[model samples]
Target: QEGVKRWLNGRDDAAFSRWQLSRQREGQFIDLLLAVRDELDRLYRQPLDEPSMGQRKARLFEQLRERYQQLKQQWGGYAGFDGWFSHDLNNAYLASIATYEAWVPAFQQLLKQAGGDLAGFYAASRALGELPSPQREQRLQALLQAADP
Candidate 1:
């Protein structure tokens, strides 16, 4: 919707300009979040048994830290911008959190049904569970560390 040149092409309409900016920020946030999540999935798929867990978890946190910074820094990208900027951010955050909560439990149950692959599933879930808040950094690291054999 944002690429519709007729609507968002010119800076003439302040509302349209704001809408474009908000869309850009939203895209950036989603990109970063997805990238971090993809890395988590990669970690889970790796065949390493024990020693690599700490290293992998550390890398995951580093990627997440970058994503968090990206979100926080670009947060001001919508400042004074209009067209549901705050609403978009809030909704995105809420949706991300809610989706994770829904996904993790359902995923755990699915893993159990498929047999015991808790380690692989939890590896991703553990990282995602830490993402909603900064305070979980330490605990998440510890959990990931302990997840190692």
Candidate 2:
């Protein structure tokens, strides 16, 4: 718990810095996926409404392919992200984005509730973790709601 508190508070640790860098890279990847999804939506919105679901899906895929190629070229032909262009991967990426968007603010609120005290924050976090699954989720939801402006 102490180690986690240190890491969470951004203490001077090489591994923590590396973890932060990896998170930043993940954020960049999420941004790229979002851009691709947005462009595809803008380009293929009309086609997506076609009566034939199969045709609409085909059109969507076609646009995705075009946009992906453009993205690759924009990134100076970096193919390391080729695996992220799939339908399943895109869904997973979106889910991850949603989770991050929801949880970060809630955690921030929890920290604020602790008055920036790391020990208090850890104790509060442990209390939350010890709750039953449903209760834990309810508490998390409450935190999220409280964090909302």
Candidate 3:
């Protein structure tokens, strides 16, 4: 095993190898997270009438939450200086996710108010969708006005 090899190779050697492995895992995680987020973004725009849209949304949510929780668990604890730095950035990202999750009900309500048709008001709002949530909300509100009249 890599760990066994590292152990036999000595402490300094182990440290570098350990860091290398961690960096590799981090890269893999980032690629996976980006891909899944893309999936979520693409699938989320579907109108409710599509037969499999609900299933797709559910799958995306499950994937998102699983990765979110995995990262939280993976990075949650103290790991001296290196971890303290990553921890700050990780916590900031998780905080944003928390804020976004809190908005889910409101987003769903907006869909309801639109009578569940996301394409009309929503399709015209992709530029806003690319913004951060607060800015996106403002842009979406402006788009809604345009879409309506």
* Each model's lDDT: 0.55, 0.66, 0.55
Candidate 1 lDDT by residue in tens digits, 69-113 = 556666853333233233423224534754554344445443444
Candidate 2 accuracy as lDDT: 0.66
lDDT per residue (tens digit) for residues 35-101 in model 2: 5456545545554444564455456556656766775676567565677555444444555666666
Each candidate's TM vs. the true structure? 0.38, 0.50, 0.33
Q: How far in Å is the alpha carbon of 43 misplaced in model 2?
A: 13
Better of 1 and 2 by TM-score: 2
For residue 68, give model 1's deviation from the true position in Å. Answer: 4.0
What's the residue-level lDDT of 22 in candidate 1?
69
C-alpha RMSD between model 1 and the true structure? 16.8
lDDT of 3 by residue, 1-149 (tens): 23344455656776777777666566555554556656666665766666687677667656655665566566664232234234323323534555554454455455555666666437534554778989887754554454432
Each candidate: how many clashes?
A: 0, 0, 0
Candidate 3: lDDT of 70?
64
Clashing pairs in 2: none
Candidate 2 ranges beyond 4 A from true positions: 1-88
